[model samples]
Target: MTFTAAALIAASIAPSISNAAVKSEGMKVSMQLAPTADARQQVLTQSAVQFSKEMRRLWIEHILWTGSYIVSAISGLEDQQQVLSRLLRNQQDIGNLFKPYYGDAVGNQLTTLLQQHIMLAGKVVDAAKAGNTADLNKYNAEWHKNADDIARFLAAANPSWGFKWLQDMLYTHLKLITDQVVARLKKDWEGDIHAIDQNEAHMLQFADVLSDGIVKQFPKQFQQ
Candidate 1:
């Protein structure tokens, strides 16, 4: 499912909006003609496949870096900040994916939300490390609230992404993260490894849902 250089260029330059021409006030001039429906559909199909692959790659990186951050942070390792920086960048990358179909503002908004999600998770890790039960409970609650905010934001953007379903998916993702953290804290090495495996699989599924919804909602933006 690789795109050739020409195909990549075509997708890059394709119109973000629909092909329909708009009329100016008191003017009857026609704009540039659009591709035929058949041609447009073919381009969209190719682009959609590529988008799915990209989404999967991004989500895989998200979980892998997050796991790395978790390990570094919990063990008081020096690379914690570096792993966290990479993980935060992944959030921005995920947000940028929406800019083609939505816009920069929306993309930035998603990036902010996702970064907050990561930061809050870090707080949770810190609390757990310090044996601060009160802060752990507080940060955990805040973390779930951030997840809710993310689900709501995405559901608002695409009708295909139902709020409840997105919420449940996000909550499950949080639980998986929590599982890994708890397993690490308790010296349950097997459980931590299993949690990482589950988290990767779950994030991939999450990526697919988002990719499918975007394709279904704005087929034109995916032109090859």
Candidate 2:
């Protein structure tokens, strides 16, 4: 994002004076004011820190709710739908975070993609539960494709976020999620816990990357 430098000027001019005994004199004064570079940088640093924290919080919520939904769905728990609803809402929350930087349309597009990701994950879980290899494979492939689309969309918006890097991160995210599902199905509690721990750490890193990219892309917004 680019910012136009605007000068705020205040000026005053003394009234003209005419007199035979005194020399006429005129005075003009003007001043332009703006924040100092150091002040601006301080504000930018604060904003970046806040953004990083918020992103980490949101992404961490994403993984936690998702894990809850996975456990509920696999175990045929009564609160599965409620957990799923909360998990889906996290996707919109993440998208809303982008609106200030990317506008409503772009934010909504991301929400759609993330919603699709969640829905595809549901299908994969169902297929796995039902022992349907064909549907599981199909939905898993589509899930990966959705991840690719998300990576492409973000990379197009900010060059600081490299496509290959984002893609790899998203792929790893998917693998961790799959590991959780597989471990749960196999009744390996320790493995499931490990995957959950890894997923949370991975998503925190992902959130940091996203925050850094946004800070780079729109430096002016973060300035004083």
Candidate 3:
């Protein structure tokens, strides 16, 4: 698990900034290129603390939204609104994490966009609970649109500070959830197999988006 966590953390860093320059800086800066094992452990420990704090906030939103549509909740999802509420809380949880990377304005803007998405997604959950497929589709469309808007902001920022490795980790986690969601829903309902297949394909597409972003922005990291 720590290896997985570390991989995710490593992936987020902005790919060695400027291979030759960063390497040169890294060498010349000499903040302590060599450290005792204890010192290295301490650094890793601090990194893990910060990483876990951010990841946990992400986990909260993931659990709330994704869990809402899980098979168990299909019958009577009274907590549909609660899921959105949890999302707001999750937003606050990760507020500080964003500040170090994006400062106040961008961080707040991103948070606002995320909250809007949560509100729209909440409507989808509400529609689903009511068995209103048409309304669910409408809300889903809005949700996707919001997602696209958020992606644009992220792309504009291009957050090169190794933040993307975390995205790969997140994408991997999302893939797992999508796989389970499709399998569980298929078993629990008689929905079209084609829909499940499409959903799975979409998950792959999303992963590709993340991968493409990483490779395009940080080709050197890929080489490494």
Candidate 4:
């Protein structure tokens, strides 16, 4: 990729702008050092796309297996800490991906929200396992509330990622997970399979939505 004359000029000019503007707008003068403008754009665009891909893969793994792990733990077939540790690591990985874009402070905030989500999910699993209907109801509500908070945080960071859409998608995610948990508890094999299928499809779409939002919001950085 070769940097065009115009790109070189713009990149050079960016630094002379105010420090606050440079930080807030994310002017990437270094990116213009690439052989071509498209090369830099490709790197950034692909990174954003891969962020969604990695997150989707991680969450899909959670959706597919976390419930089963919880079931096993509850039945004394597995250790609950193993599941929590794995999910926590995954959440940290997801959070780190955002650090390049949002910086450490905001990235850690996202990680904390995500950690809470995983913890609330664990509580839901425990309540269900114990067959404590009241606790089950309470934890389930909290889990969804955490999802709302996550959605709000994301929407605040990137207005192009609509609050309503993210909220709806995240709520749908929680509902699908709930369906799977309920089905498994009831031994409804058909329902469990259906919920898994729906979740896999929906989760991929959610990832795409986030990726698209990033591309749309930062078109200048992505355009060749």
Candidate 5:
């Protein structure tokens, strides 16, 4: 069984939302997109697939949140950094797990984003260790800018997956960075907050779940 792209995207972009929760929706759609399997096997098999150009695109989409995470940390508006740290670490771990799936082009992009994130994170950690507010702010600003560019590039290069997926998932994350997150950040900057948060995180989880579903259904296609 295989899912349609629209159903899969809906499931992936807004699982928490009503459209996604329909038992016959995403899972039904899953049959059309992939095969229906238990969640445990789904996780195990998808984990086995090597990263590919498609996966790399997905990775970049995930990493785009690095900006929001950094800003959240810098402003001390949220206490999710520890969770975010785990997420980042998991992404790094997954990158290694996925290295075998990517071609040279995809691998290079993955490597580039990973390096930038590491360097940026390191600087932030170092600033915190040294208690340098100025440095932290500087790096946080850079993180925001870099994240914006990365997100834009991702959308431009792969609009189908990037913006389409993002817009669909937007509903999940919009609640987190609502007036509160924006107001706080807005005080400092005279522009958009790019306030992606818990909802966005939830959407990413859906994407991961769907990707895993695809891999489980078509191991050979993904395994390389």
Candidate 6:
């Protein structure tokens, strides 16, 4: 699932609108231009695989990295600013993927909501670090609510997102995220490792579902 610059740049392989010269902007997108339909399919498959792989790497690694900082909470543990930067970068990557299909406004809005998701997860980690069960419950609920917002937002945008499935998938993402944080707090290395594996694997499925939905929803974008 390795994605080269060419693979990504060219992976917006969807047919152009009226054969217009293709281009992209931040969080905006279009489809790939392949030699043939089969080539296009291969490109899309690679795109989905790469999308999932990068997503899992970025997000799961984010949890592990940030969780380390939270658990330690010692001076000079790690650069907090750098952590935030990485989070933003990961999200921006996602927004860029969506931009072509959703356009700039929608893409930016999606990124904003997703940013809220990241902030909420940070809050959960903060609550866990404080050992405040009440706060943890509160923030956890908020985090879940954010997931619902994400679900509704996406489902409203594209029926292919499937409200129930997307909601469940998002919740699973949150739950596994919690698993990692809680395990870190409790020093449960086995549980943490297990959650990491689960989170990465499940997220790939989500990626596939998302890619499938996009392909189905906008057939012209992917099909000639």
Extract clashing residue pairs from model 2: none
Per-residue lDDT tens digits for candidate 5, residues 110-141, read 44665565456546444543445567557645
Candidate 1 per-residue lDDT over residues 1-224, each given as its tens digit: 12232232222222211121223332121213221123223334777888989989999998999999989998899998899999999999999989988899999999999999999989887877676656776777788788889989998998777776677667667767776777787777897898888778777767877888888778667666
Off by over 4 Å in 6: 1-76
Error of 1 at 20 (Å): 42
Distance from true location, Cα of 217 in model 5, Å: 16
Model 6 per-residue lDDT tens digits across residues 1-224: 12221122121211112132123222111223211123124445454555545555655554555455444442234676576667766666676677777799888888888888887777666655655556666766677778789889888887656566667667656656665665565556787677777666666556655665665565566543
| Candidate 4 positional error at 151, Å | 1.1
Clashing pairs in 4: 1-35, 1-36, 2-35, 2-36, 3-35
Show the lowest summed lDDT stretch of 10 residues, model 1: 27-36
Q: Rank the candidates by lDDT, best first.
A: 1, 2, 4, 6, 3, 5
The per-prediction CA RMSD against the true structure, in angstroms, equals 17.5, 24.6, 15.3, 18.3, 13.6, 15.1
TM-score for predicted model 6 compared with the true structure: 0.69
Off by over 4 Å in 3: 1-49, 64-83, 159-224
- Score candidate 3 by lDDT: 0.44
Regions of candidate 5 where Cα sits further than 4 Å from its true position: 1-102, 163-224
TM-score-superior candidate, 1 or 6: 1
Tell how far residue 176 is off in model 2, in angstroms. 0.1
Please provide TM-scores, in order, for all candidate models, with all chains considered together: 0.79, 0.80, 0.47, 0.71, 0.37, 0.69
lDDT of 3 by residue, 1-224 (tens): 12332223223222312221112321221222221123212222344444444444464444544554443344455764565466576655545445555578877887787677556644653454454546755765565556556656665665421233333333333333333333333353333233344334433433333334434444343342
lDDT of all the models against the reference?
Answer: 0.74, 0.72, 0.44, 0.62, 0.42, 0.58
Model 1 CA deviation exceeding 4 Å by range: 1-44
Clashes of each: 0, 0, 9, 5, 12, 12
Clashing pairs in 3: 11-165, 12-162, 12-163, 12-165, 12-166, 13-162, 14-160, 14-161, 14-162
